[model samples]
Target: MGDLERELRDLSTWLETPEPPDVRAQVRERLHRPARRWRPLAAAALAAVLVAVLPPTRAAVADVVSGLLRFAGVSIAVSPEQTTPSGVASPLPGQRVAGLDEAQRAVRFPIRLPAKLGPPERVLVADPDPTGACRVATLLYDGGALRVDAFDGRLNLSFHKEVIPPGAEWVEVNGDFAVWVDGPHVLSYVDRAGTVHKESARLAASTLIWQDADVSYRLEGARTQAEAIEIARSLR
Candidate 1:
């Protein structure tokens, strides 16, 4: 019985009483320390989001140039043989004539004419006269041995061979096709198929055609046949 009482007393002593108030307070502070440490991390995340929402600082000109070069399938090589422009350069070759200088505008493209075809002299915009607006450029090749006429815009192309008689309107003669631009002038050309190809566009329309042989083209943009004749006379 005495041994049992001693055992019970030992157990009671082993079972500790409640902690002191100061000790309990210290434990609570330690548990909350981790929460306080996470406050700065939350602020840093918000700052990163603000920065991502801001716009860029510089314009993308390089991207534009790269796209043009890729679409053209050509590379620009600056050699010592070429000359630099002194000021704002014109789009068309300087040597060609502009019949409608007052109304025409110029634009540039990175295109090179064949050396055998000589060089382009000028490019002009054909407008106002009802033969559908056209973007036209002329090339005098081989020192007058060849003349290349390029007309750009939406065109209806056909072929025939017949030299129309003078004073006759839209007559087919000589088995040569003549392009009748809703106006008085007519363009004529013969192809390898012995077929003549004719193309015409209305005022405000554009056309592009290229030929390697000697061809007689008619400019129909002039208000009168005399004016159309004068435009043709200026070709080469």
Candidate 2:
């Protein structure tokens, strides 16, 4: 729990809001409809307006919170309407292939390689800031069948979100918090500039996400929780 998140959680409790109308049907109907995405500036402004008030607007956030699951740098909210399993995977924002040296050079955080997975078949970096520092680094194994993403815990994750049914498991990685999402889940990624890159939205593989040393690691494609933890433990 970061200080800011804790503060925001506390703030949510003080808001008084009436019940918002049930728009699940409306939302579900629009699920298949193509709609324009709000610009980042406009979206952020709308969020500020909604959160600043204490009515149905605040209730809207509370509704999401009822099913929200967050840890480390990842956030997952259970979706109201089940989406079709994701199609093909696509590159994220500013994503590019790199060698280990280049990947390490692109991000400020320390990169951990899983000993069990050995040398990654591919290394990728994405979301470069103005200074050329990327926000996330990914190491792919079995040609991305199994992979891990490493990023700073304090920034750049607000753009990522996931959706899963109930029953995500909670565990500990080397005494630190960890979570296991065992089934297909809807995934969405939007960059800092508000670009929802290619088809980053998809039903991601079963994942094991853990936090350590102020950095968050999201390990996807693990077949079992124990196997995921073993691989995570091997990060060095």
Candidate 3:
């Protein structure tokens, strides 16, 4: 059979199967029922559409993660990006990796550290991002990296954000909807300034993210799903 036919058959099979009970609960709880049951399915279809449109060599999948909380108008999309020909994962342009004290001074919002994780061993700060909002900070622990992104400019500015290659399962964390993307995929997003960014597409870990106030916190590079959730719960 042709590849397209095989893909269609697989999609049909998935559509017929029901989502796991636990995942259903998480989606219902976090999205607050604001989204219909077909939203995720639609997202899956969108990915399929992209696959059909893009070249066969560029075929990839992404998950659209949106619901009750908009994360201050930040649209969360888990998609992949193009990579280098040499297979080298280069640092994002206009990004700097610095010490904790140095990173703290760069961003407008206060950096948060998980009680269980303590201070991060490394800190990455992004200033003058495409968004031109406030600075973005990423705290790197041994097991994973915690990202803190904020917008101090006007509210309701819509921007597209992407993370990992689309297998996100919703889970309740601290009574809030949090997403855990399985496997390592490239994470990309559009900054407030309407610029698209492609982070490293070579990440080899899972990620967990939730919102706190106006800041959207993302924890990446976890060794396991349970470890990621445990660390996320420790955020204060």
Candidate 4:
């Protein structure tokens, strides 16, 4: 057995021993001889002895001691390094394309298009996910290099657990508030099951997120905030 386990076992064994007759008599005598300045110290010692001797009390004390020791030097880092998942960052997988009409039939929300960007090169629809139990549709422009993701809910993610990067700016998009995070920030999302999705962690494009009514949108691949705002304004 390991040293710690062996020591615990030995302590348990020693605590199980019955007090000798003389020891019991001495304990009784000490209890009777009270009211002195050392009486509080003696009572505390007696309580400790009781805790060590009783099986239930000893087990409880051991649990508390072990827990405190285990957490002594452990520190949880909440910085950028801790936000991204451990595995090699991978690209979003299995993204397929469909026509705008087909995508509209598949998703639960209305799709908005940017007049400036014109018709998208590809329309990608995401299956209903557990996080929001709603479908997400993506409009890919510029040969699928630029994307606008439209869904039916809010992106309520905590900055501590998700990658919001170092600089997050709040701005207005078509009279609605939006958050712009510069890339390549770790692209992570929490699903309905509260699980983290980091498949797009290594993407280099900037992102702009905004909401209107029940619909939310995320525009990616803009070179600057002004360009993103202009594109967002074009969304109808």
**Winning candidate number (TM-score):** 2
Predicted candidate 1 versus true structure: per-residue lDDT over 1-236, tens digit per residue:
23322322222222222443323233224323444544445333322322232222110011111211000111111122323223342222223355434223432212234342234444343322234333344444334223334432122222222212221222121222122223122223323233333342111111111221223233322344433333343433
| lDDT, residue 37, candidate 3 | 67
Q: Candidate 2's residue-wise lDDT over 126-212, tens digit each?
A: 988999999899999997789898888766443345555653656667865577887777766657755544365767778887777
Q: Is candidate 2 or 4 superior in TM-score?
A: 2
Candidates' lDDT values, in order? Answer: 0.28, 0.67, 0.51, 0.54
* Cα-lDDT of candidate 2: 0.67
Model 1 misses residue 199 by how many Å?
16
Error of 3 at 65 (Å): 12
lDDT of 1: 0.28
lDDT of 3 by residue, 103-156 (tens): 666766677788878877777776454454235677776534544333332333
Encode model 4's per-residue lDDT on 60-102: one tens digit a residue: 1223221211010111112343244555654333345779988
Better of 1 and 4 by TM-score: 4
lDDT of 4 at 145: 71
The count of residue-pair clashes in candidate 1 stands at 31
- Going through the candidates in the order shown, the clash numbers are 31, 1, 2, 3
lDDT of 3: 0.51
Better of 3 and 4 by lDDT: 4
